[model samples]
Target: MTSANPHRPIRGGAAPAAHATLPARGGVGLKPEHFRHILDTRPDIGFFEVHAENYMVAGGPFHHYLERIRADTPLSIHGVGLSIGGEGPLDEAHLDRLAALLARYRPESFSEHLAWSSHGGAFLNDLLPAPYHAGTLARVCAHIDRVQERLGRRMLLENPATYVEFEASTMAETDFISEVVGRTGCGLLLDVNNAYVACVNHGRDARAYLRALPLTAVGEIHLAGHAHDVDAAGAPLLIDSHGAPVAEAVWDLYAYAITLAGPQPTLIERDNDLPAFPVLAAEARQAEIVMARQAALEAA
Candidate 1:
């Protein structure tokens, strides 16, 4: 496990250009609806991202199209079911499958959420929240170490969009994540949309949350839409449902984060309400506009 200084100066010259590394300037999640457009048009996107679990099937059009897409543009593999925060040990079979995908695709970046998705051998298919206590932190660090060791690469851990806070939490979310980076040497996939959701749900200030974050550890950024739901008590609960275009508030938060992270890879994730490729591509273009404006400011 290793940790780097968050405030250290970037060694490269002016952040390596927008598309040199990841989120690529702006990218859209590789949805089945947009395969042809992506392949034929080859739109000016930074990269394409895919859920590693969705492509776990043996053979299908999905993998075939993905292969073609990968040949043209950079790609990122995001895992949603690794259950890295589970109380038990790392799942060897799952890791082997993930490693196989990495071997075949060789994506530019690979990431997973810091939350767990399983309990007592049952897969919940959702990123469940974990307590930010010492015991859970140690367990999560060990799991991350094993994951990085098995995959033979460092992974970016995304902050979970949590709806509930456990009484056992003894540290702030940012502190817990910073500690994880310290113990495991993994980078962060700072999802601005999640920060907005968490802030609204927990009645905290969004900008302050972002300000407290260790932006230097952030390797990528995720921008997605969320749904507002109310519980039995009629309290506001924001769900990380990537079913629509990013809201304006999220865009504002993204601007702030870009200032801190200095134009890292960013993705627009739309898993539901699957629209045409042009629609999603347009949203990606909006992200490009934002990035370009930010870069211009930096150059000035």
Candidate 2:
């Protein structure tokens, strides 16, 4: 995959002068169920990520453990409710809260989805997709600009796992994302599982889809499992459920992605069917082994 538009640059802003950075290794989503275990055991993982909304409060146990765990290990703050693709202007109040959260943690990396989840003062619980065209492109870029300016750091925009496409979209998803990154100077959070799921759902080649992305801008990679089924027309339909373990097919795609983007800060995300801490830690270790193998191949 040749570089697509090499003019990508990190935008300037009043972001914090000093913040932690994610190492090019493997990480796991920080879950409350494993908080105590993590504190006691302190697993040898690269980093731990948590949803920004979970720690919006002034004080609580979440902060208690996170404050400690963060001190020892690198942290990545992932936001899911910013609704960056909304048709409306960015929410100032929500931005204010997000700004405060970032200030407190000063995570190494921060990211959000390329999907919308709110409208007309009502919030949707899920990450929704938007049409890829000039209008939506402008909106997404504007939203990202506001977020980077507010947070004072370059944000990574994760590609969405889509089950549907819009006829109104005049541009391909990859083109739209490239334009947004080139315009706003934000990084790309390459979710390998989402890429595979979207490609399979839309009958596109997964490897080709990965090749079209702005791989050079990928600061991190996400690996997750999906629920499989068939669409109304009996075609393969994969849901970004994030419930099961990383599938073998997705692992293969992850290796391919590493070959293109090099060893990124990969995260094994399992949001449902909660497993033991060791289970997640083992997955994180497996990701590390994969990254090491790919690195060795490049060396050879």
Candidate 3:
């Protein structure tokens, strides 16, 4: 018999704190703009994801609505400020707050980007890129270790959508992420939009990048939209702007990905130009349909 998820573990592994099993159906990023609609309607979403930084505060309407919504749905906490890929050591204070947040909410899954947004004791507002060399590799690995040890929970690392690549990068993005998984025993949150963006920007094969991922380590997937732009050479460049519906190429990449990895928890993220609930829900439904079709093919 074909397995439902090839990555499904057989024996003891990641604790519930690290990643509780999220339904493999589709979900959307929780936005404050849709808080009332979500609470009032209580849509049939697989789960809801939130930026951990948003809820790090002690209390307010955010937590007020979040706690209520969480009662009716699963929650996934995605961090944007841990700076796991930074050159400096991991922030003990941030990790402590993160741990406290995780304990308070007990989210089903937690993830962060592989890019660094902090440097020299200052936190930047963007998810900056990092070199994929041996030097950066050791630093990133240690940071991941610190996160897991302090939080006492497994975390998923996401791939970055890069507009530029470093000349010193000795390995491909896939290789760098694979090595991190091997060393840290952490999972991956495959971002299809990021893959498409990076491929288009670097002229790399998006499909090849997807196929090279360590499928068994993928705990979740993200789908979002990008903006059209031009590079210095007047070549087409895609910005990782999650302000609109996911593009067709990204959906195609997602279709191929589930075929290789099987049905996994997927989420639709929209941070800017926030649309109404139904709009994002429709995109997430498309993701569900694609996953269902792939599941049928695998079962056959």
The global Cα lDDT (0 to 1) of model 3 is 0.88
lDDT of each: 0.84, 0.89, 0.88
User: Between 1 and 3, whose lDDT is larger?
Assistant: 3
Query: What TM-score does prediction 1 earn?
Result: 0.92
In angstroms, the error of model 3 at 4 is 32
Structure candidate 1, residue pairs in collision: 22-265, 23-265, 23-266, 24-46
Model 3, 1-300: lDDT tens digits are: 112212222224344534567788899999999999998898999999999999999999999999999997888999999998898888889999899999988889889999999888888879999999989988887888778778776789999999999999999999999888877777899999999999999999999999888888888999999999999899999999998899998999999999888888899999999989999999889999999888788789
Worst 10 residues of 3 by lDDT: 1-10
Model 2 deviation from native, Cα RMSD in Å: 4.0
lDDT of 1 by residue, 1-300 (tens): 334322222433344231235644778899888888888888877788999998999999999999999987889999998999899877789999999999998888889998899888889998999889999998988888888778877788998899999999999998898888867767789999999999988889998888887677787899999998996689888889998789899999898888777887888899989888778777777877887888899999
TM-score of each: 0.92, 0.94, 0.94
Candidate 2, residue 136: the lDDT equals 96
RMSD of 3: 4.8
